[model samples]
Target: MNPPPINVQPLDTGTTFRSQAYHALKQAISQMDIYDHNDEIRLEERQLSELLGVSRTPIREALTLLEQEGFIRLQPRRGIFVIRKTKAEIVEMIQVWAALESMAGRMVATQATDEDIRTLWDLFRNFEMRNPKEHVNEYSDANIAFHKSIIRLSGSKLIQEMTDNLFIHIRAIRKLTIGQDNRAERSINDHKEIIKALERRDVDQAEHLIRDHTLGLAAHVEKHCDFLE
Candidate 1:
């Protein structure tokens, strides 16, 4: 039996080759083509390089990053396979992220200065202004940044490290989930409420809102997206 075909756009040479290759492939996995009918995806370095019209070096670099982020597993001389999480694992990850972000939100409320809150509102504007129909992908990146900013304000090296570690895995799942109906708009609203809660210096409210945002994401993804196993 033949393997499925993949269609990837040529890399934009304007960017660093590695970044170009990475984003191009990531976008393909996000939308265009990669997965098979069996809900799995596989590719070799040679196949990816040929598909993206780049050198093997950039293809290898992108695959390494993807593998690190838990999107793909590269078995030596076999091929790269997509590593889809189960619904149970997805719920667990989101629960942890909710706990982490809720802690970060509370810390931000208690510890973040007026200027810090001001910076958050300023960052919030980035998402506020986004046209989700035209810019969901960009909005997703901003949403990640918005959550990270609050976590950064926590001023604990440990919290920062944990959130950073969780983000790579979470991001891959988010890529699939964000395109769901009104997901971008809904996420923006949730962030708006969360920021307002933080700015009011309501610790409990901030924690609740942030957890709701993260867990809401879990529920949304569970309902709408398929976790390729």
Candidate 2:
């Protein structure tokens, strides 16, 4: 199925304000800037509004959206707090991600244009060449771009949206993985193989490569990372 065209609009004043506020709040929450000293940290709207230089309305709106996505929780009078993932929850999310990515790769193998393949190959090459010591952020950004490009090529808006939402929850775990020695190198190699499979229009190979690569990353997190504990 083809994705509906994305409508890009000129930024109006209200759209700009809400977008700025959403980004500011999202960064703070994702980066763990807000903390609660009593057991778990709750997101305080007043503090966020003051810190982000926005009003409570937009802050509340953003919190509501995040809460709906399972990124955060809102307790009646207790405040909003980030939802920490359990080991089982993390594993389940990883399984779902693997399935989605494999499906995406299969679709891309059949549907991707030459331009799509070229752009993805360039991004993968750039990711491979990044020096971990000096360009970790660049490498991470490129890695995300490459995967997002594949998802775009799948031509499914609903799947793309769900995959993006999962990424939001997995972003912290991914940061932890990025710090490991040889992890980035292995990831680049896996991406290269997947790109080759796509280039050949080998749907079976592409699906297998994508699923295995994602499951390998999940295994690393389950074995070496304490995020689930």
Candidate 3:
């Protein structure tokens, strides 16, 4: 199959090309469905150079940075490919995310204003009685957005930055798994409960609910899914 398109804009002349290329490539990789079994995604230097209107040198430097950050793999013979975490690796990521996001939830409960908490209600307002099975893709996006909102609402720059790489995996996993079994329906209910806890400013309950919600995916992957197999 053809490699995925390098979705980058032409670089501005002011900033260094290597830095711009790194961020652009990282963002593009993060947005891709890198786990699709049928699509063996690869990155090409010439293609990225053309897309970014720069030479291959900066692209190479940028790719090396991304490789070090665990976003892509620099293979000797097979070419550059996006990194897909193994099952155990993904579970570990979810555990780490659970810890960070749960603390974010605690902060949000204690610090976010009523208006800030109310914003979460909008994410799933339209999906109230609808069948998530029929709209799994859309709901999956909303679900991911809701979790991101939690991190943002926490008002912790460190937490947000820490989860940056984690989202590259977490977003993919959530999208892939949300429609499985009866997880989508249960997910909605869980979100409602979490929101209520946040609204009531119940720090412990909010933290517990958020942590358990994230950790549940780790457990599911451990016992149920063949995602990494």
Candidate 4:
């Protein structure tokens, strides 16, 4: 039997064509609109290209950049795949994230300007003030913003880059686990404790709080793997 015909189409004409394709693909992957067999998950370049009415060239380029950033993986002859994390992997990453974040927290406690401290406090207060009826997405967004604030205060570009890469995977896992209200509440409390320690300029306490908080989250997530899947 002969193979099916390939459906080739012309590329979109305009400047910013690649940028449009890149943003569309990034948004789709970030929003979990893509998935995989075993019902796992992934973002396919060809599908994205088709959806965005663009050529595969720009789609492939965007995928390549995302892969380099550790958000996706490319398998030889297979296709592009979203980087999925297992329970064990999430646990391990939580430990690393805790260490990195704690280090940032410690630095911020010692070196942060008054303005930095005020910004962080504002973010924390905003998180605390969120209405219970609001969607988990709101809380998740705030959570990311809070961490980004800490990273901004850390003054280490390398640390920021590494943590940003790790958090992409962490954020995906958090999306899986966000349905657990207990976990969400616990995470909020954890952030509070870390902030309190920072407020005191207690580096040791800040580090300990951050690590223990993350370990607690890992434990909570492990006990509720059903929510993760």
Best by lDDT: 3
RMSD of each: 6.1, 7.6, 1.6, 6.4
What does candidate 2's lDDT look like per residue over 1-229, in tens digits?
2211212222234565566666555555555412112246556677666666666887687777777777789999777767777766776788898899899999999988867877777775554455553566667667667777888899999888888777755665665566476777777778889999999999999999999988887888778756466
Model 1, residue 103: C-alpha shift (Å): 0.8
TM-score between candidate 1 and the true structure = 0.66
| Candidate 4: Cα lDDT at 140 | 68
Winner of 3 and 4 under TM-score: 3
Better of 1 and 3 by lDDT: 3
lDDT of 4 at 214: 64
Q: Could you estimate the TM-score for every candidate?
A: 0.66, 0.78, 0.94, 0.73
Tens-place lDDT per residue, model 1, 56-86, is: 9988898899788766798987778866567
lDDT of each: 0.75, 0.71, 0.90, 0.68
Q: Provide the clashing-pair count of each candidate structure.
A: 0, 2, 0, 1
Candidate 3 wrong stretches, greater than 4 Å: 1-6
| TM-score-better candidate, 2 vs 4 | 2
Q: Judged by TM-score, which candidate is best?
A: 3
Assess candidate 2 and give its lDDT.
0.71
The per-residue C-alpha lDDT of model 2 at residue 187 equals 76
Clashing pairs for model 1 are none
